[model samples]
Target: MLRTAARRMQVRGYADAPKGDEMALTFAAGNKVFYDKKVVKQIDVPSFSGSFGILPKHVPTLAVLRPGVVTVVENDGKQTKIFVSSGTITVNDDSSVQVLAEEAHPLESLDRSAAQEALSKAQSELNSAANEKAKAEALIAVEVAEEVVKAATA
Candidate 1:
């Protein structure tokens, strides 16, 4: 039997982008690199420091993202959202944002009760933290978990 090719290729370097007019965005579990699409004029996501928007023609930049909503609006006014467990988003020279997620999915399938329970647990852990760094990390976890739950129920 012949072996099948990888569903997606791992993006190596920025310069190695596919040679075409289309921009690329790659998620870890999917081979799809989101390129030109309608509806979305920009992408706004939560970074470690704060939220920022990535728009067409923006210069290349990179960011460490936190758990939150990935909202997209089509040029025609349609919108969709997904819960990104956690990941890094890289803005290429072409104005495309690549989201490398730890895990990702549509909000519809998330388990609300489970996410709520997890958020509760994380909150309790954060309250019991014995150090500053640990507390901060726990706080982030709580936020991520809460977002997940919200996305699920929203």
Candidate 2:
């Protein structure tokens, strides 16, 4: 009787479970939490490997982000663009995405002129760097500053 009852019960696999139309997104920079468990339709991320879009039921992934713009598309079709210096993005099987960035700012908050000045300073430092460590740091600064300038102007 126990075996018969067990056989009569139906078991559903993870893939067979109902999924939501939206995904939860959390974006953080340093100690600040920009978006915490916000439901969104889609996310576009810039990774060192390549840029890709994340949607509901997307396969689990972990990507190392580059210095570029991250676009979040809401269910209502509204879009928000944020600039990130560098970070990691994790997509979970439960349709949740978390972005941890070293530095992040809204596109409108960025100053194009200031970003340009920083870029110039980074380049100058790269040229004047006397040690390998300094040169490496300056190179990274240049890359981040260049992205900031582009994002600010865009």
Among the numbered candidates, top lDDT falls to: 2
Lowest summed lDDT over 10 consecutive residues: which window, candidate 2? Answer: 10-19
The list of candidate 2 runs beyond 4 A from truth reads 1-18
Provide TM-scores for the models.
0.64, 0.87
Question: Model 2 clash pairs?
Answer: none
* Each model's lDDT: 0.69, 0.92
**lDDT of candidate 2 at residue 83, scale 0 to 100:** 96
Q: What's model 1's lDDT at 87?
A: 81
Model 1, position 152: C-alpha lDDT score: 78
Q: How well does candidate 2 match the true structure in TM-score terms?
A: 0.87
Query: Which tens-of-lDDT digit does each residue in 28-90 have in candidate 1?
Result: 435333433332456667778787876565567888877777766555555566777678888
RMSD values, in order shown: 12.1, 6.8
